[model samples]
Target: MHPQPESGTGTTAGLPATADGRTSSAPPSGPAPAGAPDDGRMTWYVYLAIVISTFGGLIFGYDTGVAGGAAGFVADDYGLSSFMEGVVVSTSLFGGMVGAMAGGPLGDRYGRRPVLLLSGLLFTAGALISAFAPGLAVLLAARVVLGAGVGAASVLVPVYIAELAPARIRGALVSGYQLLTTLGIVLAYGVNALFGAGQAWRWSLGLAAVPGLLLAGGVLLVPESPRWLVSRGRLEAARDLLRRVRGRHDVEAELHEIRAVHRQEARAGSGGWRELNASWVRPMVLVGVLVAFFANGCGINLVIYFAPQILQSAGMGSSSSLLATVGLGAVNVVFTVVGMALVDRVGRKPLLLAGAVGMTVTLGALAVVVSVPGLPGANWLSFACLSLYIVMYAVSPGLVAYVVISEIFPLHVRAKATGVATFVIFATNLVIGLTSLPMLDRLGTATTFCLFTAVCVLFVLFCLRMPETKGRTLEELEARFRAAADSRAHARVSRGV
Candidate 1:
């Protein structure tokens, strides 16, 4: 049987103790304030917080997608070779790698809110600098800075939403981040088309600042993650915020559960690289890192960052390629919506398994179609395959990666673990972004796609080791892992190993 959390009593910390003995400094219990709706569907503040946090996702999507289209124009204007183009496009991902590494520790130490605010500022600054950069060096520098913000947001936004949302709808709410990301990609495609004629890639690059600035301001109105507050021993603050977001729900029971988990974590050790040595944490972190690594290894970035280039190679004109990219973006958004609706209802593992199967099939077909000489309508066939690939990806790894990483780790180590995983993701992305153009030039498109197809086949094997995480509370999931770890340790001791 799972262990139940012990009830908290009088405060041991500096904060005032609640009636239950947990530390608290909130005002006495009261009814919902006037003008704050009490209908229990979810307060306006909850919805507002979600909307504000997801702007970061929107910024993430725009910055990443803009590069795919902007690179062509920038290459034309600057007279760039394949290597130089790779540097320009991959620079932001390098920044993202740094951001993901740093954002985790900072978010864990400070709070999710402050880190998000800083990310927004960085996003704004980076966008403006990129838009007006006079030389390739300046553009690369600007993109790195902008990429840092995207990286930070990628790590933080999903965690923030996961913490705030109720378990019942957590999948749907977390997928909102992915949804906004798709919207941002769609917007970038439209912007790319608008400026493609004039080679005004600057406008395409610069426009990301608009959402960046809005996110910076909008986050100011949202509350900090209650879980973060609770971890810091700000019990009253956590309780008050929980009540506000959870409406008429019993905040006390949830608070007690969190308190029990935190106490358990404290006994385990303050979470860090050291704590990760524990058998329980190792499996979770390993899975998280593998998921992040393989998500990129599947070559989604190849599609998003170089769709136009790929299409052009398949005998399409520049205009036709750009239009097809726009179509790809549309398919991404539509299918992502479908995934979001099903995430909560159908569960996470099924979607992941299904997506793996679909991608493997489509990517394999793409390789064959491209490799075969003189195949009729091969270009259109490749296009159809690419579209289907996005559909499969959107349903599974694309949406599931963010949701799973945020959900799997213990609360104490969440930020740090997520940071490590996201760092792996962007680092992998950086390698892919840098090498894709050169690989295409050297290895040819068919061979390159076959390599990606192989990765998908490997990913299917990886999914077999993954645990289904749908519908379980964060506390429950953590306990389950802890129990398994304990069992393994006991068996080892019995064997005198």
Candidate 2:
């Protein structure tokens, strides 16, 4: 008889699950099929490890908040114009692109744990240096260093969690990254409200090191990814770790499935960066890449990074603006929990489509309200529009993009392809961040917002075309896409086109 794996939650304790916590359709008398998680109760150790690793995301959220919270103070001390303030705020984003471009190769070559550790160190160094920066140039350079670390962790964390999680609960577990990140943003905003009086913004900036330190220490306590170990030929170690993570002594079936997929990928000569353009691979990679790109285009990060500034521009006091930002950050945290519950339960595309429509409407409201001067309660109305926008964003593109990209690609090329996707996300974010203030200054708030509203419309169209990834194992997803590609090619040849 197969063990009835407990989800460690009272609600799911009686369900019978395969090795990795996926509910089996029947109580089979024999062994599971090759790709199943096998026979194991999903353990809290897996949960603990994933949580610790996801602190990398918290570090990212902290940086976004602390910088935005303190940008005005930073600008006042330096006597910076809007362009220079944007330059200071966006330097880390530019650094993120550079770090993101390198993150894939590093995670693929060095194991995920080590790369994560290095990212923590970079965050630590950058935070400390920025706290003591003597000039704009010094602070800008330190932000670049800090951005690189967060960039790498952004690529590494999602794939790391996806590989370790049971397929049944992978959606919720992976969403933990976004949860922690939002939590971090809230914490930073709180810190800003506390310490943002004078030059005290330095305190908010310096404290980012705390989460960075936690990220490194947490990685130290967890084992490396079993899938990556298999790729590196550490089969014995991979097998042992897999058994422990699955909570069963036997993982031969799962291990065999992983090996077989690698062998298939090898025989097909499909793992190289150049071959990402090949017919079988390109479709899925395009899906992942476009999903990543539009996720940022949804404009949640824009608010996270610039809410205080956006609010202050609308005739609000500095303290009132930071407090309003805290409220928005809370909305970001709450709805992300909603996303965690709904992602696997409903589906990826549906949540995203729903979000895009809501965002377009809210953004349109923002453009209309911000453009009209002396409108009654315009400050409060702007706050309401942003709050609603965060709700839409946090539940969909804000959370799901990372989950889809991490699991959609075949393992053989996952690192490189995910890297490319990660690079696009960071690059898109950089453009949004670097240009936000200048756009708000020159084009006016209403027009600037309308541009993002336009992007959400584009996001809606993309969601209609993107594939759903709910309930499918990584290996299953790869095979499904490859078969679809083959079918399309056959149809084209049949018509002699």
Candidate 3:
């Protein structure tokens, strides 16, 4: 049996059984780090797990980039009109919205790991159905399946990584998911080029299954989130797992921090859906919701979903337009890597503000270039401006929004709240995917660009007041919201309002 602590806190007394239903009779060595690196940091287990989990992102990115390139081909093969083509493209995002809503409660009920496994199954099945789909309706259904998987992965992966990482390194590790997403986009662009327009849409889409299979299998090898364990009242297992994850036996402090926070939350009865809208939480909660909404509103998806069509309208040929997007995909990947490196050091708000300024300027310039009407070099100039916009975006909101949503919520409500935020992300994303092409056709590309620029201006204003969340533990960050809630309660009492 474990020795009793002299302190009366009872931090380790009468702990519950682990999820596996085993209680430790004696203190034992922690779970072995899966791929213990020579660096002795045991966090290779973390790095390994993050890479494996983010494998879901590869398929998510592939769908994001491939759908735009493949849409025209799918339209041609099935004789779909412009409106129908938008429907085909957007069906998956609609599925993703459904998955985003479901992921939170399912994660809270089952566990994050099971949610991931289910997402992978959805990804694989969706890709296979879309690849050999013989008709229009079948293809739309397949896209929806794939979208549900992407939606679930998007919501849970950040929470998974954030909960696993140390405060000092948490931002960078969470940014790793975005890094994989960019790489997946680049891979999709390359696959689109190799398959040839209208020739191999099946192959381009079918390839997503490989990553899905990898994600499903890979999750079996990783540990469950320790916070999840502790929340389940499995403190004994949580304590041992923390030791392995952090590469040290002296994990009592961190374990206590997690346990203490949950104790307070339990006493306050804050775990249910109602707490999500409590006045104290409304401010930070809105922060996440608005960030998710605007991150998509800046019109990044227009490029991801319709870059070739936009470039083709600007005067490029089909083959050339497809090739150009490969370049755009490459730029997205490079800058996302840079953004990941910087998030921990330069801070989240600064990057969001700086990126907002750059996005505004570049988007406005692109509008002017496209509207010049046969101006010399308009297509290349549009490409130049669009490339700059991607650079601004990749380093700022592209990655920051997900990181912030994952890090800034009470532990009890974290996954559920993130699910709500990511739902907005997919919803805004769906709006762009479904309407952007129609908007471009009717509103004129220049006018559409201006609308996005206006959104960017609003984004800049939001950033001016958004809180910074770098270098703080999840427990520490949640306290800020509680402190705000407490201050308001005090004010109400003073005035007797």
Task: Give lDDT tens digits, candidate 1, residues 29-116.
Answer: 4433333221224678789999999998899889778887899888888899987887888999998988898898899888999999
TM-score of every model versus the real structure: 0.92, 0.91, 0.92
Residues forming the 10-long window of minimal summed lDDT in candidate 1: 31-40
Model 2: per-residue lDDT, tens digit, 254-323? 7666666665676677466876887888998899899988889777767888898788777778789988
**How well does candidate 2 score on lDDT at residue 422?**
84
Scanning candidate 2 in windows of ten residues, the lowest lDDT window is: 1-10
lDDT by residue for model 3 over 395-485, one digit each (tens)?
9999998889999888888888998999998899888888888899999999999999999999999999999999888888888889988
Clashing residue pairs in candidate 3 (N, C-alpha, C atoms within 3 angstroms): none
Better of 1 and 2 by TM-score: 1
- Point out where model 2 deviates above 4 Å: 1-35, 38-40
Question: How does residue 359 of candidate 3 score in lDDT?
Answer: 95
Indicate the TM-score of model 3: 0.92
